[model samples]
Target: MAAESGKIDPMHQFLVEPLFGQHLVVGGYDISFTNSALWMVLTLGVLWVFMLGGMKRELVPGRWQAAVESLTGFVGNMMDANIGPKGKAFTPYVFSLFMFILFANILGMLPIGVVGLHAFTVTSHLTVTGVLAVLSFSIVLIVGFAKHKLHFFSLFVPHGTPVVMIPLIFLVELLSFLVRPFSLGLRLFVAMTAGHILLKVLAGFVINGLNAGPGIAAIVSIPSFVLMIGITLLELLVCAIQAYVFALLTSLYLNDAINLH
Candidate 1:
């Protein structure tokens, strides 16, 4: 049974099969297609359709237009609430980040089995999350330096500390800043990865129990199906919350950089 289970390897259900090999033998550079890339493209395509469909100016709004407007308004409000008046200039960056993340997350929830291909949750990967965090960090660093020049380094210093306490406070502040990217990436990756793994394990139990016997299986399957439904709904909420948290933290970081407080 263990061997059979190993052969089945439920985790391999999300593995990406390469579509291309190394272009130059010496360089060993390979460009391969991946499930994550497919989902990202799908998300971008969906976003393009929605945004384009709603681009027309009309006296009365259609459903797509309403959705676009609502999403825009929500992001706008979030920027206002989090970053204040200075955030107005950051609206484009924040909105783009929110939409990309939101769509990537929503696309992960689709039932890809019907399409005869396994779906990988892109956000579950530390590499993907790390890239996003690093991008946000770069934006903060660049914008801060551009705006304040050398004075931006003052972010590491606190205003109200005694001379003796300044070193300790500065050390704490510097460490906190250094950990931002790791924390941001890990939080999203862990949440999505854990949720998907839990769902997969529960699903395996359901499948195994159903193969046991009709009477016992039926009793077990009922609760399994109910749990699956509950988990699916929870996953939907998790997707949104993770994206919002990421964008919210990013806005906060940007605010910190701009205001230096």
Candidate 2:
């Protein structure tokens, strides 16, 4: 039974598989629609339906409309708190980012495998998260330069650094600033991947224990099954927390650009 479970490849789930036999190439780029892309489309479609729930304009909102308002209001308040008065203008972008990531993360946790469909966690991929991090950072750079011009360079130097230490401090601050995107992307990718790998390994254990014997099932499979349930709940909480952390950090970074503090 251990051998049987050992044959299960935990990492195989992360593999990007193409849905179609045919391929599309443009400028030497393989733009083929993959399982990852299909899930992203599903994520977007679900999110769109969720948003439409709020369009009733009723004086008293039902549960679905209330949920929509709650999320939007939460994101809006986060921006106001993080970026201050000027944050209102960027609310749309930040809100979109928060919802997309939240939905993507949650969608991956759905119990789709029971229906002969495997859910792909898009956030587990570096390319997707890196693009999001870069896009956020790019906006910061654009806003900083557009508003402050060369004065944006002042961001690297502290307001009261001693003359002798200014150079060292500037270098450290610059390095930290430059690493934001890499760290942001890496954090989410590592987190999502680790959680999924752990869950898959636990599942393998359950399967193996059941097949090994009734004794092994009582000793291992039942416990493993219970543990999987607990971890699943924890992962769901983590999904929301990570999404909030990413959005909050982005807002803070934008504050630096907007206020140059």
- Local distance difference test scores for all models: 0.81, 0.89
How do the residues 87-139 of candidate 2 rate in per-residue lDDT, one tens digit apiece? 99898888888888889999999887777778999999999999999999999
lDDT of 1 by residue, 1-261 (tens): 111652334465455545353232345654566556777788889888988898776789888888899888898999898889999899888888888887887777777756665566778888889999999999999989999999987898888778888888889998999899999999998898888777776666677777777886788866887898899999999999998999899999998888998
Question: What local lDDT does model 1 show for residue 96?
Answer: 81
Local distance difference test, candidate 1:
0.81
Candidate 2 colliding pairs: none
The C-alpha stretches of model 2 lying farther than 4 A from their native spots are 1-6, 21-23
Candidate 1 segments whose C-alpha is farther than 4 A from its true place:
1-8, 19-26
Report clash pairs, candidate 1.
none
Give the range of the ten consecutive residues with the poorest summed lDDT in model 1: 1-10
Per candidate, the number of residue pairs that clash is 0, 0
Best by TM-score: 2
